[model samples]
Target: MKMTVFGAGYLGATHAACMAELGHEVLGVDTNRGKLAKLEAGDVPFYEPGLPEVLRRNIDQGRLNFTDSYAEAAAWAKTHFIAVGTPQKKGEFGADLSYIDAVIDELVPLLTDDAVLFGKSTVPVGTAARLTTRVSQLARDVDVEVSWNPEFLREGYAVADTLHPDRLVLGTRPGGRAEQVAREIYASLIVDGVPLLVTDLATAELVKVSANAFLATKISFINAVAEVCEAAGADIAALSDAIGRDPRIGRQFLNAGIGFGGGCLPKDIRAFMARAGELGADQALTLLREVDGINMRRRTRMVEIVRAASGTLIGSRIAVLGAAFKPGSDDVRDSPALNVAGQLQLNGAAVTVYDPHAMDNSRRLFPTLDYSTSAMEACEGADSVLVLTEWPEFVSLDPTSVSDVARGRNIIDGRYCLNRQDWESAGWTYHA
Candidate 1:
């Protein structure tokens, strides 16, 4: 199968490369010339583990290519996958669909014959049906079918998730050829025992957002428990360990940390709530507002903890460990770690951040904050150290070595990654 993936951002790029790895010829189409150029040169614009290798290998093998022209992409493949971003609108909770509209507007007019457009982007319910109508209007003598096939790739593990998804979903109208097309596209995974759930378009659109909403809820639920534990002088780690033993509640996102923050969870929940409100079922998702609130509060609470640890934040030197939302990726959109660092900086604290892969992106997002090449360098002359993201290197740091660099041996484990006993044994005041 040969396909063109429009909007070559994180999702698009990964999908394109992974499709090629699945023995399909793929052309990644995007409006961003710089991104297209980088992809053509075998350079990934973002940090996703294992993606660079897959992308480079596929491109080198002549199975993958990139372009910025819609005509070229339309001419190259009859099947198109919409991998564009549906980010939350500014000053609004609903998704801005301009990009999706733009893709259809640009690609449909250029199609001279039959085509199938698989919407791999997370979108509001009913969007696929609406896009189907729009495609029919714009396409010139072309039989274009629009279908919903939302992606479930996590940021750090996008390549693996794409090539070997746990389940494959294809949502289309009655008598449509989208399901057959999807089967052919993901024939390899289907043969590997991956379940394929065929459904109506609306159900497919809801799946991705619902998954993200549930995950956000789970993280916030644990963080809310962490709040109660804080007030009662109880240990969250011990509680998590005991409850996680039950098979019903496995501890995946149960780590009570600074809370969930990435490009997906925050915006997805907000959009879900907004969509529900528009549909007159707003009360059903009211708890998600609390989930959103709990997540945001964790960042503020972390800042408060830092202020208390440092005695006075006015002239404090704080070392922030990890700037990305999580380990293994350089994405910092809505990152709780960076939020904490930015808040501390605003409060007159001189903050230095260190991350294994996110330093460049962190600097781009926050140019004012000081960044260091390594954890030891960031800890130099710091009043206190705060582990915001649970990167492995930060977890295994030698407390004794860090103690020597910092003016004060004060450490706060925001992610609960540090071993308290080890730090305390090194004559450091440890706080979680």
Candidate 2:
């Protein structure tokens, strides 16, 4: 199968590369000259576990290529995947669909024959229908078919999810060819018994937002329990362990920590809330507002716990372990861990932050905050340490050695990743 993925971003790049790896000829098109040049040179600008290798290998195999020209893309393939970013609008909860609009604006006029455009970005419901109308106006010789095919790849596990998704979803009109082609495109993954669900475009658009909303709700639900634990003197880690063992209410996102903050969850929930309100179902998602508030408050509360443990924080050295949202990737967008460090810095604390891969990216986001090359270096001479993100290295740190390095042996297990008894046994005052 030949395809064009319009937008060589995190999603598009991974999708294009993986599609190529799966024996499809894929041309990735992006208007950004620099990104196209980088891709052409086999350079991936972002850090995703195992992505660069797959991208480089596929490009070497001649199955994948990238270009800045939409004409090149439209002329090359019948299957076009609109994989651009539908970022949260500035000062508005709705997503900014301008990039998506621009893709159709640029590509449709140039499309010479009948083709299918599968929208892969998280979009407002009804966008596919609206786009279908707009695209027909742009085309001359051919009619453009628009369908919704929202992607569900987690950032760190994009390749595996794309290659072996738990399920494949395609939203199209009744008796549409888009669904059939999508099935063929994902045939190998489907043959392994990956469930495929086809539905109307509106339903498909809602699926991505709904999935993200559920995840955000789950994380906030556990954090709410953590708040209860704080008041009642209960250990959230122990409670999470006990509840997690029950198969019904599984403990996947039940980590009672400074809750989820990444590119997806925060924006998606807010956008969903805003969209629901527009759809006159505001009451249905009002809980998400509380969820967002609870998640944000944890960062502030974690800072307060650290300040209390350190006595006066005005001149105290605080080491914040973990700057990324979660480990395995350097991306720090809407990072809860970094948010705590920033708040602490504002309250006159000298905060030194560290993450295995995100320290450099963290420094870029907050250059004023001191960054350390190693987790141990970060903890050196600190009045208190806050385990913000549960990076494996932070979890495995020897509490005794950490205690010896710090000015005051104060540990605030914000993520509850540490063994509280071990830190206390090492002569450290623990606050979680």
Candidate 3:
């Protein structure tokens, strides 16, 4: 199978590499010259575990390659995967479809007859159906078919998620070539018992946002419970454990932390709300606004707890552990950890931040905060340490050693990743 993947950012780049690794000929297209240069040099722009090796191997084997030319991409593959970004529109909750629209506007005219374009980008529900008509009008003497196959891979474990998805969803026109081509493209997953759900374009487009909204709701649900736990003097970790035993309420995203703030979740829910409003179903998703508020409140509450613990944050030295939204990937689009760190800094706290792979990216986004090469270095003589993001390194940190480094022996377990008993045993005041 030969495929052209548009947008060589996190989603597109990972999809291209993973597709090539699946024994397909892939050409990744992006307009960013620097990103293209890096991809051409076999370098991944972001940190996704095991991606660089996969990228380098596939590129070396001549199966995965990248170019900036949409003309070349159109000519190269009959199956074109649009894995572009649909970031939130500024000042509006809806998604900005300029990139997806641009892709069709440019590629439709250039595509030959008998081509199928699969949009793997997460968009509003009606986008694919609209794109079908949009592409038909734009195409030059070509029968262009549009399909919605939303990508379900999370940032940290994207490669694995893509390669071995829980289920494969496709939204296409009735009995179209897109469905047949999609099966061929994902033959390995199909053989491995991955459920392939084919539906109308609207449902397929809604599926990705629905999945993300579910994840966000789960996190917010537990965080909402965490609030009750705080009031009732109950531990959220224990509560999550109790809830996890119930098969009906299986605990995957029940992580009670500073809350979810990744590239997905926050914006996807917002866009979903805006779309519902536009569709005249404003009351359908009114709870999502509350969900978003709960998630945001967790961050604010974390800062308040830290400030209360440290007396006056006016000149307090605070160390923030884990800058990335979550571990395994170095993306901080709406990172809760960094947001709290920045809020703390803005309120006059001397903040020191640390992450295994997110330091450079965090520093670029937040140059004011002091960054250290090591977690221990970040904690060196700090008045208090905030375990903002739950990374394995932070979770596995020796409590006594970390307490020994901090000036005040006080730790705020923002993500609830640490054991309170161990920190207290280590002569440190642990607050979760």
Candidate 4:
């Protein structure tokens, strides 16, 4: 299989490399020459576990390459995958579809032969069908089948997810060869027993956003209960453990934390709601408004906790232990930890932040805050140590060592990942 993946960002880069690893020749197309150069040199622009090796190996094997020209990409392959970003519109809940539209507009007009363009970007419902019409207008004499095959890759585990997806989905229009083309493209995974669900275009576009919305709802639900637990003085960790044991309510995403803040969950849910309203079904997803509210509230709650821990935010030296949205990846977009750090700083707290992988990105996104090379360095002379991202290094930190250098022994576990007894016994005040 030879295919071109538009937008060589996180999703496209991973998909391109993984497809090449699956014995396909893949050309990653991106407008950013710097990003394309990085990909071409086997250097991943972002942090993802095991992605560097996969990308480097595939590039070394000559199965993967990158380009900036849409005409070159069009001439290279009859199959194309759109994995561009669909970020939320500025000051609006709806997603900005200009990136996808750009890909379609730039790439479709160059297709010299029959092609199948698969969408792996998470989009609002009816996007594929709408784009199918647009493709017809631009493709001219060339027959281009526009289909939806939304991606479900977690940031840190993208490689594994792509190489061994739990399931495969393909959405196609009537009388199109997308189903056959997609199956042949993913034949290796299909042979490995990965379930494949074929559906209409609208259904496939809805699946990705719906899954993200559900996940955001679950995280917010747990955080909402954590709020109650705080008032009643109940242990959210213990409560979560008890409820998670139920077969119907699995333990995944149930951990009471500061909240989920990544590129996907936050914006996807908002776009989902906005799209529903546009479709005259806004009332159906009204509860998602509360879900978004709860998630944002969790970040404010953490700031309040930090203030209480330090007695006041003014002139306080706070050590923020993590900056990435999650532990395994260095993506700081809408990161809850970084959000709190910024808020604390805005409140006149002298905040020093440290993360194993996200320091560079965090520094770029937030330059005012002090950045430390190591966790211990960040905690040095701090009034309170806040573990915000639940990284393994932070969770496993020696409380005694951290307390040794800090002016105060106030430890706030924003992720509920630390051992309460160990920190408490170490003469540190533990707050989650």
The candidate that wins on lDDT is: 4
Give candidate 1 regions above 4 Å deviation: none
Every model's TM-score:
0.99, 0.96, 0.98, 0.99
Candidate 3 lDDT: 0.91
Better of 2 and 3 by lDDT: 3
List, in order, the clash count of every candidate structure.
0, 0, 0, 0
- TM-score for predicted model 2 compared with the true structure: 0.96
CA lDDT, candidate 3, residue 12: 96
lDDT of 3 by residue, 3-115 (tens): 99999999999999999999999999999999999999989999998789999999999999899998899899889999888999999999999999999999989987679
Pitting candidate 3 against candidate 4, the one with the higher lDDT is: 4
lDDT, candidate 3, at 6: 96
Give the per-residue lDDT of model 2 (tens digit) for 1-432. Answer: 999999888899999999998999999999889988988888876778888889999999999999988889989998999999888899988888999999999999888888999999998777899898998789888967899888999887889989888888899988768988998898888889998899899999899889989989888999999889889998788899899999998979888888888777888888899889998999999999999999998888888888778888799999999988887767798999999999989999999998988877887899999998888899899989889888888888999888778888888887878888888888888888
Runs in model 4 with CA error above 4 Å? none
Candidate 4 local lDDT, 1-432, one digit each (tens): 999999888899999999999999999999899998888888999999999999999999999999998889999999999999999999999999999999999889888899999999999998988898899999969899999999998989999999999989888988899999999999999999998999999998888888899999999999999999999999888998999999899889999989999899999999999999999999999999999999999999899989988999999999999999998899999999999999999999999999999989998999999999999999999999999998899999998998889999899999999999999999999888
* Candidate 1 lDDT by residue in tens digits, 1-432: 989999888899999999999999999999899888998999999999898899999999999999988889999999999988889999999998999999999899999879999999989888998999899899899799999998898888888898889998889999988999999999889999999999899999898889999999999999999999999999999999899889999978899999988888898999999999998999999999999999999999998988888898999999999999999889999999999999999999999999999999999999999999999999999999999999899999999999889998889999988999999999999988
Looking at model 4, which ten-residue stretch has the lowest summed lDDT? 204-213
Task: Output the better candidate (1/4) by lDDT.
Answer: 4
Q: In angstroms, give how far residue 312 of model 2 lies from its true place.
A: 2.1
